[model samples]
Target: METAYIETPLGIASISGDEDGITSVSVTKESSEKPSTKIPVILQDGALQLQEYFQGNRTDFDLKLNPAGTDFQKKVWDELLNIPFGKTTTYLDMAKRLGDPKCIRAAASANGKNPLWIIVPCHRVIGSDGSLTGYAGGLWRKKWLLDHENPVKQQSLF
Candidate 1:
């Protein structure tokens, strides 16, 4: 797979894929790899979408994704995609949607293992009490993304 790194407000983002479509997009505190002088053709659009996302110019991703995971995990990740921008859902809700509320833990596990990061939007999952819960990229980044997607608008004091 061809890999490319790009600087993001969150940090360095590593995007990887080939002609089969984007396989992964992950963020890190730092990366040894430098931003690509020539991003691979397969990854160019995905990278641009991510940049637009961070700039608040894009709400939903529209790139081909090919995240590797088990069938159950794929199901969970697919459900995550249904979550709208600026909206959040709980693990229990995800489990119920998957046709078994008892699978909340499994759903949470799949959510935690989401490989596409912001593209899949596992960060949109929250605790039942509406508290920010687990996020693979760390809670701070999750909070930043949530805030960036749905910033509080200042009210007029007329």
Candidate 2:
């Protein structure tokens, strides 16, 4: 797999992929990354889309994802893509929807392993009581993403 790093508001996002499609989009613990020049041909469009997303011009992504995981993990990740922009869902709801409430832990585990980060929308997942939960990218970044997606517009009083 080929890898390239891009600087984002949250941190450095390491995007990996090839002709088979994107395999991963991860936020590194590092706070900064050098600016990109020419991206790989296969991953170029995905890079552009991500930049647009951060600019608030995109509510959803349109990139081909090829996250590598087990079948169960793939199922969980697929469901995550269904989560709308600016909306949130609980792990219990996801587990119930998958038709196996008992697999809640497994589901959560799969979510934790999601390699496609923002592109896969794993940040939309939360605790059952509407609280932020474990995020591979960190909870602060999760909150920032949610807030970025659904910012509260202040009304002006003239």
Candidate 3:
């Protein structure tokens, strides 16, 4: 496995991957001066894609991903990918879609464990009441991402 740290708009992001594909991406408030492993090619591609996304030139990510998690977590992550850009969904809604409305908490927990960050679209999930909830990247960055994707048009004010 290889790892690298990328400085993004939100903060310093740690990227890790191997031949199987990118495994994890975590955003932190502090920078990592040294990584445990050499940077990999897969992570290099992911970093480029993230840069494009922040620039608003990319809506969907194309890099290969292989997030490590439990079976249920993988299912939740897969469902998250279906969430379109510029849109949002609640944990309850996702739980209902999964055919288990009572599993909202589990769904939320799985969403929180998503390792791919924006590429996995975990930021699109929110509270049932439409309020922003817990975000691993911090609520402010979550708000920024959601607002960036769903920009308020000038016509809306008119």
**TM-score of every prediction relative to native:** 0.93, 0.93, 0.89
lDDT digits (tens) for residues 109-154 of candidate 3: 9999999989999999989889999998889999999988986643
Cα lDDT for residue 150, candidate 1: 81
Model 3 off-target regions past 4 Å? 32-39, 153-158
TM-score of 2: 0.93
lDDT of each: 0.90, 0.88, 0.87
Lowest summed-lDDT stretch of 10 residues in model 2? 29-38
Q: Any runs in candidate 1 off by more than 4 Å, and if so which?
A: 154-158
**Local error of candidate 1 at residue 34 (angstroms):** 2.7
Question: What would the C-alpha RMSD of candidate 1 be, to one decimal place?
Answer: 2.2
Q: Candidate 2 vs candidate 3: which has greater TM-score?
A: 2
User: Model 2: per-residue lDDT, tens digit, 34-62?
Assistant: 65676888888888888899999898888
